[model samples]
Target: MATKTRVPQTIDAYLAGVPDPAAKKTLTALRAQLKKLLPKATESISYQMPTFKVDGSAVAGFAFFKHHCGYYPFSGSVVPALAAELDGYVTSKSGVTFPPDQPLPAKLVKKLVQTRLAEIGTRAKKLAAAKKTLITERITDAAVKEATGHDWKAWMRVLDKAGAAGLPHKQLVTLVGRDVESGWWRQSIAVAYEQARGKRVVGETATTGFQVGVVRTLPMTAPQLWTWLTTQPERWLGPGATLNAEVGGSYVAPRRRGNPGVRGEIRVVKPGKRLRMTWQPDGWTKPATLQLTVMPKAKGASLHVHMEKLPDADVREAMRERWSKVLAQAF
Candidate 1:
């Protein structure tokens, strides 16, 4: 009988099998550092890359090609500042690389990978935040005109007439406070309405209410941050939404057929800046608005979120707790 070769179980053994000597050596050094840092990690090949499985999920991976060696922090969203440090190399939205012959920036690589592991600690908190924000935005409602210190009903009528009207972030900031926007009052109203109505609206209708509040600073830039928030329906917002950033465009969040708990949509959008939207609840008179403001800061940017037409006190309190958690993701 012929003897079978034993498959590699350690990163070192895996690297030793690579064809190129230079790539192999660099991978050896990289694997050595990762082993030292993550003693609990198990090495394996996943998606054809050398993956490090921490707990159960593949936390990181690496591979060597002809021109460069690539390192993948699976959920690359963890390290917000890593992008700048990787400026000299060729990079995209996800992975980073270093030339095989050049000395590895071992320290930075370790820091980036290690940070991803740390993020797993807060996954529960992040999910809870997202859920709570979805719930609070739909139930509340207040006199939009009074809370915003503007005759908003009149303003709505104006937009209704214009046929392509959407509120701008700058104009909103002027209305609510130094930090206000067009829909700042809407989130509050939706929350209140939900409390009074005692029903969920997300997956049942054209629009639904949601809870909203300010989000703390995140590690990403204003542009990236906005993209992430508006695009959630595409990722985890259940059946997802039809997103349109155009002025007169419409956003639709269809319900999961026969299921009433999941949905998403874009109620209003003011290109690159302000947005009004609906989330998991489905069906109602109107959806709450999410207004995102980006004020440039020294290190990054200060994000002020204005949620308009939110609901009652109970809804407000619930939403605050929820948003505190959801906002944590940005950092």
Candidate 2:
């Protein structure tokens, strides 16, 4: 029996497999440039093409076709958004096809990808909200069969070959994402394996650390709540903490007494409605995230606080209790 060959698992491997030396050279240069352009983005082979993604959305990609190369600025809007700059290049709303042996201009490529990044700012907020951070609702084997036409045993058999058990949670999710195409279901499959194989357990998320959510209907209107919170955030956030109400505005806060102070930027701000910002109580590791929303009700508004990326259950519980007490007594 013939041994089946393994598919290329990375962008470098995929580029090495390209038959044409000219195309390979061109794309190699393009990849190097893109890495510099999108220093914060992750590079990988997505959809069997060289893709650069940020926040799990494909921001840019490129490939070799039969007669030419194509640059794909994903999210369905980048190419058209810069139609004026793309003149003289054979461009479609989907992607730009170029000469087989030549690459797109580095400056133009920078502008194109950066614009796409800026466009996805508010969209990233929605994506963060939409992402399945944890598998709170367990996915059953019958549900798996319904989604992918395969039962748990059969799915496990396939995952075994890919070494899914050994793969990290992110890689396992990506592997499932390629087949399922839905964010929530992809997480469900990955988490199912984690649970069955002892990789994780209930009340835990592999990516974001422990999470805590608290909601309270304050005896104040939405505008009143926003004004009080933004003007004097130190009361609940921490002493000497400042929350600039403008999106992209900078703020500072003290962490542990001995640790250095840290700075964070507000990500999204809908006046009198919602606010999302980074919370760095430790100022050492990645900062936690805090999302607050106010929804108008009878005489007052409901204030919701969703915090994630806590270090452990202790921190989660501590934060949960703190927020509960603050909201109950302070409001």
Candidate 3:
């Protein structure tokens, strides 16, 4: 009769059960270094191997196989991204195989782990975005019919008849405008059509250059955040700021120096929910739209910063960094 083997419930058990001295020593050192680099990560046994997960996402893992050891980034794209630095090592789309006797260098291990972590972070953000409400959700089928005398399917049919799929953004908008009266509704319908046909992506519009948004979750309620934002405007808006918390009210955000002050009007104010406004700082070409919103979450709440009409990708990145800093430092 054949004997059954017990599986390891922990990484330490897995390491101890490795019969090969070289493979055990190599895996032990690699595990120690991974723990050091990923102090915040949760270590667990996944797929019968020692794995390190960060924020519920599997980043890096390792396993001992016959004749060699394997390092897994758990992402197909990670290995390809660093293919140039992986010379002399046996690599696949998912993992890298190294000789057990001559364990991977500390530098190489660091690169592999860091690259996997970065890829995981980017994937997490994209997944979060995918889970958010879509345009169709915001503009419901019934609401569309009530507002424009047609449902989404009907509007799509109308646009399709106009050859909107092959038309440029402006021309498509013009076509929609022949029926839709309001400029805002025309732009919205055109964008919705473009998104449905896979022509335009989220946070992108021909007229608005580029749009970017960032969200930060804080351990507080929406009302609490609203108080902080309305009272402590200097933290985010700028220093010596005067913000009127009402629709059609004008406001000013005076910077210290070098960076000029912003002057704008509050376009929409839904207490503890959303605040939309237009801002044009000193020496700016045109005003940019700024929207701040608060959403309730399980633990606390989320603060949202949405900026539109950015001049280019550079400005988009700059505003992203600026808002990230504000979210991190403020509240």
Which model scores highest in TM-score? Answer: 3
The better-scoring model by lDDT among 1 and 3 is 3
On TM-score, the stronger of 1 and 3 is 3
Q: Order candidates by TM-score, high to low.
A: 3, 2, 1
lDDT leader: 3
Model 3 off-target regions past 4 Å?
128-133, 137-143, 147-331
The residue-by-residue lDDT of candidate 3 on 68-123, one tens digit each, is 88887766567888888998888766678888899989999999989977866675
Query: Relative to the unseen true structure, what is the Cα RMSD of model 3?
Result: 18.8
Worst 10 residues of 3 by lDDT: 312-321
lDDT tens string, model 1, 1-331?
5443344554556677677878888888888788787789888764335777777655667776656787766653543457677668765334666788774587787777767766665664664554566433432324454455434345434434543123332332233343235454444433333322443333222132344465466666677756765666433232445566555555554444322342335556665566655543454344455555655555666666655445432333333433432453333
TM-score of each: 0.38, 0.41, 0.44
* lDDT at 327, model 1: 50
Per-residue lDDT of 237 in model 1: 31
Could you give candidate 2's per-residue lDDT for residues 271-330 as a string of tens digits?
A: 888888887754346678888898999979988989877665445644554565457456
RMSD of 1: 16.4
List lDDT for all candidates, in order: 0.54, 0.73, 0.79
In model 2, the Cα lDDT at residue 35 comes to 88
